[model samples]
Target: MAYAADFYIQENIIGYTGDSQNKPTVYFRSGHKFGRITQAYPDSNYQGRSLVREYTDYSISNRPPKGTAEEYYNGEVRHCSRYPFIPVDDNDSLKAVLAIAIASYPYKKPIYSK
Candidate 1:
């Protein structure tokens, strides 16, 4: 069963003081009873530059680290250093889950008409 959770998005916008070009780095984090999951989108721009999104799903049985926010966030950063994709018993199930997650996000369509 799906559990209740809170999702957060952290964006880092980069631009020169006088430049109009803005580059964004987006990071997503969701926490649930089972565990927490995080995704990072680097060098995201209007051109849709492909970035390696990282994900981690900590099991409920795992123990939480004992430390402050710095340590916790640092550990998460390290955990994301590994590949994000998790192997599921059924490929179809994995695809379905991923599809739902992606659909939940408020993705903007390309402004081709304008």
Candidate 2:
């Protein structure tokens, strides 16, 4: 099955905003079983000053369950929502990618180094 972490990564990239450079937003979506990465951009906006926002609709598994902050910090549950940045930047989306990459040992792949 597609790892919940992968979905989390894709969602973060889709919603990422790189300062205000107007750089093209990038995202990665992995298949449930094969674990492949797909890139897509539903919509992007750059209002100058390096302010950018990307939007997409995706769901992830391995996320921390909703609860009070105390519950999460205490290690009561794995709250994915609490950790938005996993593989990449500490944004809501990158967290999933980070987790999946680490768990799958995809770091060996040269794609990330580039």
Candidate 3:
């Protein structure tokens, strides 16, 4: 039973993890990884944790400040002193989700719904 959850950011484009020691989340972005999604336990160093958490010895050797957004690939900023992601309203979220998906894969520009 995989529980859908939120994510964090790392300097690496393919490294986003969760929090769980026994069965940490497993993520494989574009098949770039074959291990854990949530950084494989003791490996989760959320910016939400602490400097120790972000710079934990078991995690990435170069963990940026925890304020980095997970969507950094979409021109999202890499890091900030505070939460970097913009809060989207429900209608915007639903509409944008479809638009993004279509724009990311469709053959041509799409006329977005109003």
Q: Cα lDDT of all candidates, in order?
A: 0.25, 0.29, 0.25
Clashing pairs in 1: none
Q: How would you encode candidate 3's per-residue C-alpha lDDT over 1-114 as one tens digit per residue?
A: 111112111211232233222222222222222212222223234311111112111222222566433422223333222223232233443333322222222221112211
TM-scores, all models, native as reference: 0.21, 0.16, 0.21
Q: Give me the runs in candidate 3 sitting further than 4 Å from their true place.
A: 1-16, 19-21, 31-63, 67-71, 77-114
User: Model 2, range 25-94, lDDT digits (tens) per residue?
Assistant: 2223433221222122232221111111122323333333532111122224322322232224445544
**What's the C-alpha lDDT at position 13 in model 3?**
25
C-alpha displacement of 10 in model 1, angstroms? 24
- The alpha-carbon lDDT assigned to residue 89 of candidate 1 equals 32
In terms of lDDT, the poorest run of 10 residues in model 2 is: 44-53
Q: Candidate 2 — which residues are off by over 4 angstroms? A: 1-13, 19-21, 32-114
Q: Write the per-residue lDDT of candidate 1 for residues 22-98, one digit (tens) a residue.
A: 22112233342111222233422222211223334322111235321121231353332222222223333333333
Q: Return the clash pairs for model 3, or none.
A: 17-37, 17-38, 18-38, 26-37, 27-37, 47-66
- Residue 68 CA displacement from its true place in model 3, Å: 7.5
